[model samples]
Target: MNSRRTALVVMAAMLGSAALADWARPTIKVSDSFKNFKLDAVFPKSFGDWRVDENLPVIVPPPDQQAQLDKIYNQTLARTYVNREGARVMLSVAYGGDQSDGLTVHVPDVCYVSQGFRMGETRDATLQVSGDIVIPVRHLMMTMGPRLEVVTYWVLMGDEATTSNTQRKWVSIRYGLKRQIPEGMLIRVSSINPEMDKAIPLHKDFINQLMLAMPENQRDRVIGRVSVKKDDSRS
Candidate 1:
C-alpha cells in the first residue's frame, strides 16, 4: 500500500509540473522583429577578398537529415568562398521564424557528428567585428580520416546570444516572463586546414569582414544590441 501511494504522489507531481509549464509558456509572437530576416539578402557572395567558388559547390546533407533541417529552419545558407590566395572557407547559416523550446537551432557539432565526423572540445571565444562591435563565438574542430575541418560559430536567440542550452533556457524564461517569443539562428564558418592555429584566425578574419560587409540595420539584427560608447572628446 505504501509503494502504491508513493507512485501516485510522483505521478501527481509530474502532472502538476506539466500544467505549470504550459501555463508559463509564452504565446505572444514577436514575428515582426524578424520579418525582414532573409538569409540571401543579408549574406553577401563577395566580401573582402573572398568570392564564391564556382567549381567547389557547397555540400548538401543526406536527404533524411536535410528533411529534418528543412522542418526546423525556415531558411538556410551554405556556400563556399575562395580568397585571392586560393584559400577556401565554407559558410553556413540557419534561421527560423519561431525558435521555441522544441524548435531551436541545431548545433554544428551535432550536425557534423551525425555526418560521421569526430568532434573536438568546443571552446568559447569572442570575435571583434570591426571597431566597438564584438560578438561571442565558439571554436571547434571536426575530423574524418584524412580530412580536418576547423570551425567557428555562434547561436542567437533574437538579439540575445545564447551559446549553450543553459543560456538558451535562461533567455527563454526571460522572454516567457515578458510574454514575448524570440527567433533563433546558427551562424557558422569553417575551413579544411591541418593547422588549428592558422585556421582559427582565418575563420575570425572571414567573420569580421562578413559582418562588416552587412548594412547597419541588417547587421544589427544578427548582432543584437549595438551599444557603442560615444567619444566625449571634441574632434
Candidate 2:
C-alpha cells in the first residue's frame, strides 16, 4: 500500500481512547535508512543453498504507538512463527515494565520469543514518546529465524491519544523486518516430511520455501548461524 494510506490505517488502528472513531493521523519521521552497509555489503555468503523471497513484506509499528496497541495485542490473536525441524521459531515483543509488557497480554501456547534473542538484555532505546523499544540487528535476525547480515529499514507511525487526566500515551509497534538475505536462503512455505510424508505448512511462505529448497545436510549449518546467542548487552 502507499505510505500515506498505510499511515492513515495505522492511525485508525491506534486511538485506544475510544473517544472517537475519527482518527487524526500521527506525524511521521522516517529514518533515511538503517540498512547497515557494513552488513548488507558483505553478501553472497553461504545462503546454504537456500532462497529468500525478495518481495516479502517488512513493515513494523513505531515505538511511539505502544499504548494503542495494548488492546489489540491483549486480544486472543495467535502468536505466529515458522518451525524449523524441532525448533520453534517465534516473533515476539519483549519489553520492560511489569509482566504486563508480555505475560499480561497472554500469548498463545505455540508462540515464544525467538531463541538467542533475549528481550530483557536489549538496551532500552527511547522512542518518540515516553517509552523505549528494542532496536538490535541480531534481535531482528532471531525473530525471522534466519542468519542475515543485511541492512534493515525501520519506519515508525504513531497515533496520539490523550486521557481524561490530560496525560498522553503511545504504542510502539513493529510489523516485522525487511532485509535482503544471501541470494539462496530457503524458507518454508509448505511441505511434507519425508519420514512419514506428513503434511507441514509453515504460516510464512518464504520460510516454507527456504526450508524445502535447502538440502537436509545443509539445514543444520544454515540454521546454525541463527543459533548463536549474541550477548544481550549488544542485542
Q: Which of the numbered candidates is closest to the native, going by highest TM-score?
A: 1
Q: Give the per-residue Cα lDDT of candidate 2 at 85.
A: 48
Model 2, 51: alpha-carbon shift in Å? 17
lDDT of 2 by residue, 148-183 (tens): 211111111111111111111112222111211111
Model 1 scores worst on lDDT over the 10 consecutive residues at: 226-235
Per-residue CA lDDT of candidate 1, range 96-212, in tens?
Answer: 767767234478767788789999756776666657666666788889999989888878776765568777777777777977787777888899987777898788778778888
Prediction-by-prediction clash tally: 0, 33
Best by lDDT: 1
Off by over 4 Å in 1: 1-24, 102-105, 226-235
Q: Give the Cα error of residue 16 in candidate 2, in Å.
A: 29
